[model samples]
Target: MENSASNNILDFLIHLDPFDQLPRDIVATLASTASVKYLAKGESISFHAFCEQRYLYIIRKGAIEQRTPLNKLRARLGEEDQFGFTFLAPLRDSEDGYRAEAIDDTLLYLIPHEHILDLCEQHPELHDYFAATAKTRLDSAVRSIVKKEDKGLFFRSVGEVASENIAVAKHTDSIMTVAATMCGKQKSSCAVIVTQGEVVGLVTDRDMTQQVVAKGIDIHLPVHHVMTTNPILINSEDKVIQAISLMLQYNIRCLPVVSDHKVVGLLTTTHLVHNHRTQSLFLIEKIKYANSISALAALREEKQVIFQALVESGVSAEIHGQVMSMIMDAFTRRIIQLTEELLGPPPCEYAWMVAGSHARNEVHMLSDQDSGLVLDDNASEDDRVYFAQFATRVCNGLAAIGYPLCSGKYMAATPKWNQKVSRWKDYYSKWVASPEYNKLLSISVFMEVRSVYGKSELVDNLQEHLHQTITASPRFLSALTRDAIETSPPLGIFNSLVLEKGGQNSNTLNIKKFALNLIIDLARIYCLSAGGSLTGTEERFQYAVKHGTLSQASCDNIIGAYRFITQVRFKHQLNALTQGNEANNNIRPDEFSSFERKHLKEAFKIISELQDVAKLKFVQGP
Candidate 1:
């Protein structure tokens, strides 16, 4: 190729992914060695391990359609779309033979496989882009986005932010001595007590005040008596996000940071709050300490700001949802406590459960309340009335704090959903035993209930009953599978009526209704069919793979698709918020770059393929 022509090719390559992620000089090298081919309409190229030529094909100006050896259509590729990733790998890893035929006169640039192999060797990060799996490509895409953003301290190792001033004491140390150590030059708020060089317990300033001063216990007593034994510890090498997750999960204020089972430092809520990068991420702590519903409501704007930060930070969707869900959980729990305080404690035992997206821990900006109440079976009529008012206040308070009330009334505030244990079991029994089509919608909302507050055992009992009843019913999964496949991802972007009117001429894509929910619903069917009780969509699919119900490859493909779709939705919503518009699921088509449009089509295809497989696998079963 001439120098000017090579430069033009380099320009196009640099604008594409993987190449765009590469250094310009390297991309220029690839471009200089690239070959261009023009395929007339109806002309084709066949790919297989045995083929002498293996090159990554980039469609420059036209459309192409890939077909399997069985002559079934594989994918439709447009300009900026690339194919033949499987051919870039070793022969043993290549996909089955496929043919790519030109649907229009196509101008294609072919990057020699050997050159890409050399590129991968030089830049190991680029390897994922050439892997035969969508999972690899999607993972690489996420990493690329995160690498571009201002990664927050959440991405840093816990050791970086931990205080090395942790007071080290022996298990046999007296309470008075440990307290003295905490107040010494170290000025530590916590102490790690060890026995035989192993961490055995943890003590904090609160323990000293509460155990010794408040109770006037013997100051000379061994610290072990008042210390929290078998205390939770975090690895120094783990990311700050893991530390945050641990603190939230166990409701702890401090963690002993260990290296090779040796106490190295201490981390506390105080340490986290003092850091600017992570201060705003702890809105859950604020929610917990809020004095009233008004105070919690005031923090709602802060929640949005934290959400924007999370999106900008380019964290994975799972972590993003987990953080948001934790915030929601805090809000709900605090609201329930305030409601109980005002209305007086419940007359009977109960569990406050969340359903749908919240239950799955997939809460986003648009998520609303999908909750229920399971009361103790022996409650009286008057007890029911008191509990009814209690739940109403909690639900309304949640609404006041930015969690909208469920439009479908799948909430504890609804009398039909707030019932005794026996009634809840009966509802599950009726839905599972008969497996009627219309009844599935209501049951599906509560398909994965998680006890957010109160007695968790009550919720566990209901989950066991529901799972057991589902196992006994033969047609329930088939019904769920049928319902799942009722909607298909668009064969093309707009095929599923995925587009809503953006204006007089442009159209917007309803990403949730058309995309995210499809994956969520499929995950539920797969997990429930396997008798697995996992709730999160990604984990449920992995559970399916673990139990031999789904292939690992399929699991990877689906999860990768789910993650990509979620990123699209979140980034779009984040963009909307930044632009002062209401964050929503509807995204305009023109907003997508060539890169996004191409990957989105791949994601849509994966969902469509999985839906087909589910229909055949579950709906066809006896």
Candidate 2:
């Protein structure tokens, strides 16, 4: 029985890819160090503690109950079930280790800690997997258990609390009279212009100023002449965020809120701005006022508050992504400007490129700095030196302004990432033309690149050329689609949550990589394949819809998946930031209510479905 149990443990370790990378001697050492153990029902394996050393414990028979802080919930582990060492291998506090309690009489092999340490010391890559897996598990746990405010944060439907005493004007009313009523009564920006109490036209200060005052139209002109016809309006039951988006998209200050085709109320920029419950006004202000390094740095520090407020206010995930992106862009540009000031002007024409999250404009509270540069084709050695110096300074300055340097140095200073436009085009052509492993990765990275400063045309030209290159190469798109499919959300059979094996977050979800990135990657591949330049995931979906590449229902599903995943991530980060914890994408299950847990599970299910469809569509057989 003992020898059979030992073989089972060895089989389990063999199944884990990490062991396959080890030398035979190391594997033998691990096998010798390991001990087969048996636990009866109610046995406490972890004692609510992480294994001091990395322990690969695999259940040979019976079951192990993984207990949550909330006593009512327990995850059952059956045959071949493994749980241990979530954070023990160079563990960070961010990760959670497993705590195992036996559910039935169970047999297990406790792999020796010394062997684990020795193997990790020999193979840093193996150690890294442990750390990454730990982090991923921790992030997942945070997602599963984190608490969100019960009240609809930002976009609570405006049906009840919304002011229904809306003033309306006829399209024939004089512009001056309408303006007088608005200014005189200190009323919200616009009144619903109704024809027999049915919304026909809406007038606001922006419309009045742009159409009447700016155009020097007579004030005595009828409101019908000045009022915006076919104005963007919202349902009274709609979220205030929907109203805000309508306003921002059209540059309108007010929108008529109609119900059952009857004017019920008016939603104004002022109402949204003043009503603390309506939106994250401070976040908008921060993004608006952040024009310099100091301001940006200040905003970065206050990002937590802004994020929390925004999530609580019910800001739509799409708008939230954009707002965060815009603010990060502002900060990044300011850092680049400050760096330029410190280093003086470059010797030649060059464009600073925002790489990664900033490039995609999907920055979160703890977004890292991912950027590079591109010089003109005809640059001298002296010019290259200057560009390099400027990029180094810019990266350093950015590090100071909250964007930490990437460990891999995927920055402007790196020659691989920074090059002349001609060189960049050559690289793109080589990648698409051949599509090797390194080249495919390069293209994937390039998908997120955008111009932050300097010659935007260079970056724009590169984008156009890359679009042509990718469109010309079907293999490149297929490879990208395969890459995208690799890190899918871990929604298990029966649509249950698949928790990480070992770590502080042993049973959590990685919302960013698994959830958010799935949508992001899908959008990216589809957009690039379709010759679309839209960056934001939601925007890409919309673009696809507009171009007839995807159905409206498909677009809605993608958008819904994105929103559900992002909202949870944002809320998790908000909680961490508020609690003085570093902002991260991992979430624990205990932090969530049962209802939220069900919702999160459903969201991941949607993501998984989308991924399967995308994979089927994009990836071809060998």
Candidate 3:
């Protein structure tokens, strides 16, 4: 074997699937036994049960569109995807024939059939990966990725870990009685308030001190008056991840676990802290009590560790992002608190709002600051000055912890973003009215704003106003749709490179820019066009489907693509972190396993198909 060709082949094989699961020496040996082949566009390779020579064809570059004997399209292959599984079986068990035509100028690595058989024999674990069925192979590949990840943290039901030591009292019970009950022999931190055998509210130990002792409230008053009404509750059968997400979303220490509308137990931060995997709950508690910026900054490493745990927990991307965003929100809220201690109280009412991914609860390790301030409309000039300084400190505090400052300067620190409520509404009205003014970028980033701290109604009002503005303007959706489809996903991978349309190729793929953002942008357009106010990407798609703007099948397909792509991005970043490099979105083409490449090609096609659907529905439709 030629040294250069062997080295190149080994490099490519080392990162591809089933091969990746095998030993390096074995892969190198197989690479040495492989031959290279090229096919021009429209060229076809005809297969039959018996052939003069047989080889497992792994696509090295360009596209191969497989077709049945009748000329119906089968599967399209791209770089890193293999297509010779059916003929790999021993002659006694061989399957029928098919034709593989080059959809583009193509390069392929042909490993002698004997080499694949010999390797699979030595590594029985890879049997399914190279089976005749594509679905089985893909399933095997996905399972391999989760083999080592701890599935318990994400899969365990709430009832498994929740403490059954909850204190329950009637709505008519006096505060003193419920408070005493909480601290009595049961020694629970919270009590569930019920009425007519129906759980109605919740009150925590801290509530006793702040709402009763500090305020000098009459302890004899009904617990309902002091209890948090309609408190967040979790079902006993729900996954622990859902419980964690709820705790983070509502910023509560305990959740009443109800079975059949009856309070059964309590799931508290204390219960979760006992499980090493749920350290996020413990981390949040630490953030709430940190007295200074330095104290809060020291916990940055812990945040990353929890992120690592979350990814390793094998949770879905939506849950992963929700957990991460909750951490971000905790940091942001605490930083504001400490800043206030340093600079006196805020002069007037204001909401510290987060935008983009943060607002959508889809933040990842790569997320940056997309934030702003919404002041009460009555805020004076002096109040504006005060809030501006306040914004700077909070932004700087976030940067110190981990989140990078937005390169586009969309943070609260930017003067334009720190505005009175009316001005903010006016900004949306003007943006929607003048889509021709090229306001898409600004609007796209801030369009998903949600208040993380202070008056949430401010952000809610703005979201409603945004939906109304989008609904009233006929040109806005058309313009937004046009902008949304401007960037098409890559035309699949080239040799050790990503090939976008227009003959451009790069060694590293911008997974966020080319793939993820395109889906995100489309979701935004669909949801907003349907007069929906949902923010998260998955939920927005669900909103579109529920509102009759998107089909349920499309919603499920796109959301599946979104999850797969997100998982790959996170895995890439995780791999980088483990290797001591800074995590990023730029993924090297060769870093993909054969399994990932196969699925990614499908995912890319899904995005491309959805983009076409958007063009016809929003751009070309009424």
Best candidate, lDDT: 1
Q: Candidate 1, clashing residue pairs? A: none
Error of 3 at 1 (Å): 28
lDDT of 2 by residue, 262-378 (tens): 877766565566656444433444444455556665655555555666666656666666666665665666667666776687777889888667777677777777776888998
Q: What TM-score does candidate 1 reach?
A: 0.93
Tell me how many residue pairs clash in candidate 3.
1
Instruction: State the lDDT of candidate 1 residue by residue for 448-474, as single tens digits.
Output: 899989899999999999999999886
TM-score of each: 0.93, 0.59, 0.79
Of models 1 and 2, which has the larger lDDT?
Answer: 1
Q: Give me the displacement of residue 273 in model 1, in angstroms.
A: 1.3
Candidate 3 clashing pairs, residues 3+ apart or interchain: 17-594
In order of listing, the candidates' clash counts read 0, 35, 1
User: What would you estimate as the lDDT of candidate 2?
Assistant: 0.66
